[model samples]
Target: MTTWTYAELAPDFRYWLREGLPVGLPGVVAVSLDGGGHYARRFEDAPPALTVEATDFLLPLQPPVLYGDAQGLAVRLTDTGRAFDDCEVVFQAESPGFMLWTIHTGPLADANHVVRVPALPDGRAIRMISGVEVTCIENRDFADPTRPERTAVGASRR
Candidate 1:
């Protein structure tokens, strides 16, 4: 298991996806996307700003999450503190790439969610890793406003 803390939300964060994940696998990814609302209950002194936990393969601890196979996984990180209320875990599928998971994190809205990127630059990058091997990496223009054409990973073709 690996934990991503709020402090480590910079530079880069690394986690593993299932090994031997198919390139064209459909609805093959799951994640825990929280708006850091859980941390609000932590009244203890020096409460953690944020933290995300996942298996070595990147499967969420609080499954099963949902994402349409056709959606894209877009993550946006910010320093401005904000509030994130929606939180849950489920398995989802839509198309191949439409916009599966769109993460927006900040100090105020401290977030605890899994992102699919080695280095987060503002909010524009989609990369995939199957097990210990990197399967593919693609950089898209943030201004294009076009969703990706494939989901990140999957066990087998659906």
Candidate 2:
């Protein structure tokens, strides 16, 4: 339940995917945080004089909601300011080396889900917990994407 705010369209504002990676498609998100956390994006229309791409920071009272599975773990937002119904929660397999996680959640937000990474070579150790597609993981409608291949970083979830 961490809430972070940042300018969506600012030069100084840098998120996780700073290298301009295609998170999904054209509507790729610049910032990627712990699965199911509040994200603040700056709009392009922002005034240019604004040097600091961020302002009025407000962190959530509760800490980040940690989980181990392939479900919606982060908040998803659309370019039009609308959030999707469900977002995918991609987590690193709990196993050592590269292993596939047994996911049971639908797209991530519809129902409770789980991801179990077995033991392998480069196990789920340095990977970050994240989700794709859903927005606002608070007491609201949540959705998610199921792809261990994405969250595990270098492992195959198959």
Candidate 3:
């Protein structure tokens, strides 16, 4: 019974997804679009959370996607190969030309991950795959206002 602002435009829209590994692991978290160069960061200790931008060019190529853990903290999409699944619209809000859409992929993940998506893509849409739940925020606003453009390698966002 949840409502989506953009659902009317694309009723079947679903957010992309990612897997959340246990904290403290050491590895590289990479994100990339079909043609765009990949962005990656290697960490000695896995971070508690991460955020990435769903560029306008790539978004138009596919439906939106999300994956959340417990604690209501949006996560990143670690794996983009998995197909989209049904989800529940937990929250939605209108914001001028854009909107905010939050969904629950299922029970809070074992890692207490969360993913926030503000917005989609097409026939073989330019997909974006990452190594972790993607949290899509409005392009006009910061992913986390308090930590604008701040990324703490191998640190926690708590």
Q: Which ten residues in a row have the lowest lDDT in candidate 3?
A: 1-10
**RMSD in Å for candidate 1, one decimal?**
18.0
Q: List TM-score per model, in order.
A: 0.16, 0.24, 0.21
lDDT of 1 by residue, 91-151 (tens): 2323334333332222123433343322335444443322111111111111122322111
For model 1, the superposed segments whose C-alpha errors exceed 4 Å read 1-68, 74-104, 108-127, 130-158
Q: What lDDT does the true structure give each of the candidates?
A: 0.25, 0.29, 0.32
Q: What is the full ranking by TM-score, best candidate first?
A: 2, 3, 1
- In terms of lDDT, the best-performing candidate is 3
- lDDT per residue for candidate 3 within 1-158, as digits (tens), equals 11111111122342222543334443444455443323343344556765656541223112223444342324343323332222233333333323344454542222223355433322221222332213222211222323222111111122
lDDT of 2 at 53: 28
> What C-alpha RMSD separates each model from the true structure?
18.0, 13.3, 19.8
**Candidate 3: deviation at residue 92, Å?**
48
